[model samples]
Target: MLVKAFDKNIRQNKTTTINTNFVVIGGGTAGVCAAITAARQGTKTVLIQDRPVLGGNASSEVRLWILGATSHMGNNNRWSREGGVMDEILVENLYRNKEGNAVIFDTVLLEKVLEEENITLLLNTSVYDVKKSSDTKIESVQAFNSQNSTEYVIKSPIFCDASGDGIVAFKAGASFRMGAETKEEFGEQFAPDKSYGELLGHSMYFYSKNTNKPVKYVAPKYALKDITAIPRYKAIGKGDKGCRFWWFEYGGRHDTIHETEEIKYELWKVIYGVWDYIKNSGEFEDVDNMTLEWVGTVPGKRESRRFEGLYMMTQQDIIEQRQFDDAIAFGGWAIDLHPADGVYSELSGCTQWHSKGIYDIPYRSFVSKDIDNLFLAGRIISATHVAFGSTRVMATTGFCAQAVGMAASICVDKNLKPADLLEKGEIKNLQNELNKLGQSIPNVPINKSSNLINEATINASSILNLNQIPYNGDWFSLSISAAQMLPFKANQNYKFKVLVKAEETTTLQVDLRTSIKSKNYAPEVILETQNFNLEKGEQYIEISFSNPVPNNQYGFVTFLSNKHASLKTSNNRYTGVLSVFNGVNKAVSNNGKQTPPDNIGVDTFEFWTPHRRPDGQNIAMDISPAIEAFNADNIGNGFVRPYGTTNAWVANLNDKNPSLKIEWDSEKELSEIKLFLDPDYDHPLESTLMGHPEEVAPFCVRNYTITDLQGTILAKKEGNYQTINTWKFDSKIKTKGIIIEAEHPSVNVPASIFEIICS
Candidate 1:
């Protein structure tokens, strides 16, 4: 090392310039996804992250779990996990870090980005200035890294601003909103008033550990001494840690970006003050052995500047479940909001209201209205404050950002700007490309013209009849009304036989119900009711509705609550099949129902949600006429996931060697084949703190082989746990037909495939 003397008290740092096709700012969930997805789509991408690690709020520094449509399984959106790159990250995290260690999750994201050869990751770099080629286009960005004392100039044709605070968009002079809109502005009844607060706050979390031996703790001088100042300090608990303290928030009233450091200090005071109370106050016990293991140095920010785009999504778009022609992504999380006062407020921590189904997110919401080359993503995307409550979740933001990545690739290819893709055909092309990558838009199916499998005849060795779920000696009491949501065929008669046990003679009422809307999972419409008188002992009981299903949709076979009755449950769980209860998740419901204020632009409905694994077992029952939705012909239906119907082809549980064959009239050359498998989309894969029970989804195919006409294996994979599998041959494989053989991930669960494409 050499020391240099400064002349005239002037010094300079090394500077570098990099050229890329696309640039993604802030390596949070959205930016990481945008960069990875664009790189995978053949665009050279540069990812700039100010933090040392990727995964902004979800990183080990913040440790907030990644949750989206499957809102901790607290809502009725079934099979609603965000797909594409986000799904891959979550699935990989579940497989490797089911314990939900935040450090491991960080590694998962880093590995994903590193694996993509087209992505160049720059960590510990912050953008301080932006260069504009024109009033409407961004030419480059200037970033600096203090770690290496270097300045960087990155140039790109397209730029995506996924930074939570909207740094690039703000510096680029993009129009944006920082607070709530008036009720008259968008006819939004749920808009927060000035007194109630206009913005959600920032939060920090701490973790505690038990030391078998006693440990002492001392409060710092800066720690707050008064804990009772918080309105809900009694809600704190000994077992609570990390995200449980999501209410320990502040700084929403101040400018979130400029005053971030100040807000972090306030959060720190609250966190340490709360800990001091827990240790010193007489209210808690066994505290001598407890010690703080980790404390968040940086607070997780919730909201800031929402940039303007062609379309500003409002509360109506979410509540109405509106479909957009240029839809490229979907979100199902409830419209959740919090008061500006945060933990010190007298109001509850949050107010959440859910929609009946998932809603579409338009491409227009991501493209900047003023800047032609800028793509908005994450919580900074174009949306009213009322709508941001639902769209701000990490997974949902990442899903929308994936669409921006695909759009960026197309823009680079066509030498066009982001807004140029708004043309009908261009948007459709973007949608089709996203679907091919396993991202399913609401009510949108893959185009048939793009897949060669649609032109051939398909058959499977055996299709699952789904006649019965064998009992596993597990009995669950009917503490509340329970129902099995079954995908039933149109105009089909149904009868069920279930094993029941009663401590005393009880009257059991069985009702068949369906949703008023075909795509909804809520059981609101009662088709028929049947009453049965049961004896005191365990026995088999049969209930017949007599009425056939009116349409091809999911029907609920309900068993009303009886204090002395219990029903048998089975371990066999299948895709598009779940048992729900008429109960409250408390997180999204108020006493088993959503009773919003009249004319508040929200609905009143009961929540029917499924239980997590090792608990919400399927009801053991036998049906007279088997459900006919699981047929071999479904492989070519173009739908990759469950919609109004189960679009998957499921194999018989008894069939050991399940195989699907695609045949053509003459030999055809194919170089690539793709298969879409079921990964139990209903399960919420929270990235950190929320531990899962399984290493791989039970519905995933564990082993599979692809063979040609000569019975020679072209591709073979074992221990598979992903949703999308692709096979590319070094040379063309010419054959009249191709066969795919797969083994079920679980013995009780059958092997299933959503769609197969060959080209």
Candidate 2:
């Protein structure tokens, strides 16, 4: 509502009021992630950035890689792609234009916020003061932009300050501290022998390609007498001069930490001088032609303010890999420390690298010890210097953002505060929510292999490390009551199968759910089967879906539900039609190994479409008998159509039979079928349709001819003719896209074919 009015008196002009549910203070890495998370979870989130853009140091301003905890993969710790926002950005980088992690830091960061609809981003906005109710309870915040003298007020139930400096916490009277702590503070062994005020200096980095290109080496004007001989610690490998850490490169060591503005001013001179030395040395034919891509306006900050929280994360917690009930995220970055003294000083000592085992951060890291709703994210969370050294990375910060957002959601939904959820009972549900989004927390069963839901499948997962859990013999027991949420096709048939491999006699109880029902949908589950006890390897079973399958409604929109997450429709449509058991879509097919069945002592939920295949006379996905297990539901990203995928609908079935189903029309085509057997969660295989679609054209009689993705005749065969029979052919291919294309004989006129059969 815009009101056109004139103020009679300039001094009596009334200001406008702004309100939001979640007001995040800083717009750094964690702040962005937190705001995105909250918005994704259906919250009214507002992110206030004092700077022009969201990223603090890791943006165009600083130009730093968002490193997670170290990996044991190489010299550095492995990168965890399971992290959502961080992983999304990294994956997008892989897809976008990039030579070698040459990050387009700012644009990608902006895309993430824009993708989420619930978040409101504020740039060039600074939080100046806090309006607390009575005695330290913040009622609202006053923000002022220096560019414009006008000030604004922001009110919210929950707030997250992902600022590296604990900006909001300081303003809100929340307890916080800066600089390194004494050894006695947290009993950290890595603290300096005598705690000093010195901190890890910041870096004003610059990027250029082909640093190893032939160039004459001439020392800068300020270079020491024996600068080339100085010991250099390589932060980045592959023989680059800028890869060197320490020595402050061009600025004083203390310049990076205390006087950032001064350091920014000094770095330009140093970089130019270095380049001048190279140019004056007659390094190249065109020394003047060299290009400088970036000069960091935002200094790469290491240590800042550490806010006080209910539970201060410590190094002991990391060394022991301690599991907490409120676990929100994990980090394994080494504790890298730096010195405090200026250049040419031999007496500067700092701490780095605590232990080999990484650390687990609890939800307590987000909450301030003194504030009710204020949460801290990014490097300012309540972590000891050593532990902060690890969790401070951008990837780990994303996890905190995701976790704190869930907590904030709980606070809003349940009308509780951050402190209330920090206690034992309140945080369990929030942690569970984080686990589904792939947060690294203890006791959250990850990667469980389900043998009870599908036949021909081995319950296996890396997170579970199945090899360590001794196997048992005679694992092929027929299943009962195992639920599954798979892709179901209307009027199609499928077979569910599972094979349990155990070396010893063991009792395996797997809970499964092949169907979900709320106010709008009903149980479309025609079969919920399970099996028990097989050998240590391959098993076979099949459940058919030829009956009147269930297809209630493809899209259901619930506006009154929790946060109104589904956006397509309201009234979660319950179309009482049998799901197409057999259809012509890749995801509508019956079977192949996808996700490992969840049967880890009843703490996991997992399901997937039997390698869905979308092309054929009747593209169907089926498997053998269900592995004896537990509850299950539809496995999906929860959208009728999601980005980077085909338009499809997921179906859930519950029964003891290995039957799969799907729904499709003339949208695309019925050509080649595909089966994606994903053993590694990171990369799933795209192969022919379970070796069965290859041997049979789904639309063939007893005779069969198959084509590949390019419509090339890969195989041809002749046999008997039948209509009401089903045939099964096991797949044995070591490639992706296990396609089973229907061979069309161009030798004659175009022939119409439907209702494929093989038995």
Candidate 3:
């Protein structure tokens, strides 16, 4: 063996230059996702992270659990699962690390970026300086790697600033802001009355475990002296960890970016003090075997400098649920605002306000208005303080990152600037591409140009007849049953079916009603009523009527409770439907006895057990064409709700070899096919606040086969777990039609498909 001797006195500074199509700064969830999206689209990309580990706040350094649409299981928003790269990361996390280990999650994020062939990942690389072609566009960026003593000059056609603090955009002279806005600025009601330069604070979290042996902790000199100073100390319990300490924040009245060190020290004192209180204080009894397993050295920041873009989303847009023409992403988390003083404040920890449903985030919010080549993602995207309160979450930021990355790839291929893509009316093309890649944009239909179903004559072997499932066994009292309030237009006659169970011979009265005002949830007006005689068991009844509805109204159905009768309910409910109930009064039965509402106002949708009428007569076997599974709109609509709705195309359970066939007008060149299947979003993704043990849903497609018009088998897949499946052929083949045969995960359940596209 030969031993090589190295010279200790040698000193050298190495500089490296790399060119790529896109350059991404800050390898947080947004940066990692943006890089992956671009690389997967065949664009050469570079991802630079200041920290050594990936996932930023979600890493072991911070240990903040990734939360978005679900809003930490707050029980407000529904059907709000994040799509695109964030979905992939989450599904993978659930499958691989069921235990929700932070260390394993870090590896998962790292592996995703590393696996992309076109991506160049530089960990522990800090981008400090940027070069500009003019005052309007970024030309290159210079980053330093302290670990290797190297300087990297990265040149790219387009650059994304996902640094969370907008570092690249700031250095490149992009217009930005760093404070809360006044109420009159954007007509935002949630804005502070007096303008202030305060950002959401930074926080540190710790984990504790029981070791079966007594562990003692000695307080440091800088530890907080009195735990009584913090009013939220009651939240600290024996099993609390990670996100459970979201309120352990500080440094909001200071510069979040420049004063990060001071913030970290302040948070450290509080964390140690809190732990000291738990260990040394006599308040806790079971701590004899409990010890601090890990504490975060870095403070996870919430808000910082935000870049200015073509459009600045305001609080009114969120509250009004404004639908933007160029919506690329959606957010449903409430407008959660923390006190500026953080833990030191005497006021409550935070305030949250919810919308009726998820709201749209436009593409204009992701591109800089002045910086021609600069794009933004993460918390630094162009949004007012009130709007950022909801969009700043990791999952929403990841979707924004995916959108920017996809747009950057389009810009490179079209040889256009970021703003040009919008001004030239080319955003539709970008949106269509995103849809093909399984990114869901509410209200936007699938790309018609690529979906063969749009041009072909589509038919299915058997349509799913949801009415066949009889309404029996369970009966909820009308007074205590939570019914969803749907928006109804005036003078439009509509028919709906409901199942009524009668214990004795009696007359049942049902009334259609509406709320008195948009602000109130109580019903005040009865539009119409139908009286029916019921004998016994469950009987399906149809009600038809037309009435004038007030402007901006919520329509609901109420039934006068009969002592012997009850309304039947389906096992599942649809999204966007609100459960109508009295927050002030408890529900009372006919016997004058109080009973809890079967489905609370929190998680109820359509409660009426109704199905489509077939053959112009009320029959369960004959499926109506309007709600048939083969309807093209059912497969093209971007919305995927829970089963038992018209949004999804479902095949009957009895169809042994059911298949969907698309016959094109003529032979066309096809290379790829993409399918979006149901993932059972109603099933909570996380078992607890941490995460769920199982990653994949049982509702997802398990086995499927695709065949061409000539009966030539094109492909076959088995035991599928992913929500989106993309299949590519060895070469483009000319085919007039394609047939897809899918089997359900279980024999008695129907197979559901959301959307399908071919390109």
C-alpha root-mean-square deviation, each candidate: 1.3, 19.4, 7.1
> Which ranking of candidates, highest TM-score first?
1, 3, 2
Between the candidate structures 1 and 2, which one is better when assessed by TM-score? 1
Per-residue accuracy of model 1 over 257-341 as CA lDDT, tens digit each: 8899999999999989999999988799888999999999988999999999999999999998998998999998989999899
- Score each candidate by Cα lDDT: 0.90, 0.46, 0.73
Minimum summed lDDT over a 10-residue window in model 3 is located at: 610-619
The lowest-lDDT stretch of 10 consecutive residues in candidate 2 is 460-469
Model 1, residue 473: C-alpha shift (Å): 3.9
Model 1 pairs in collision: none
Query: Quick one: how many clashes does candidate 3 have?
Result: 0
Q: Ranking under lDDT, best-scoring first? A: 1, 3, 2
Better of 1 and 2 by lDDT: 1
Best by TM-score: 1
Query: To one decimal, what is the Cα RMSD in angstroms of model 1 from the true structure?
Result: 1.3
Worst 10 residues of 1 by lDDT: 583-592
| Candidate 3, superposed: residue stretches over 4 Å from native | 1-12, 73-77, 193-197, 468-481, 484-633, 636-645, 681-689
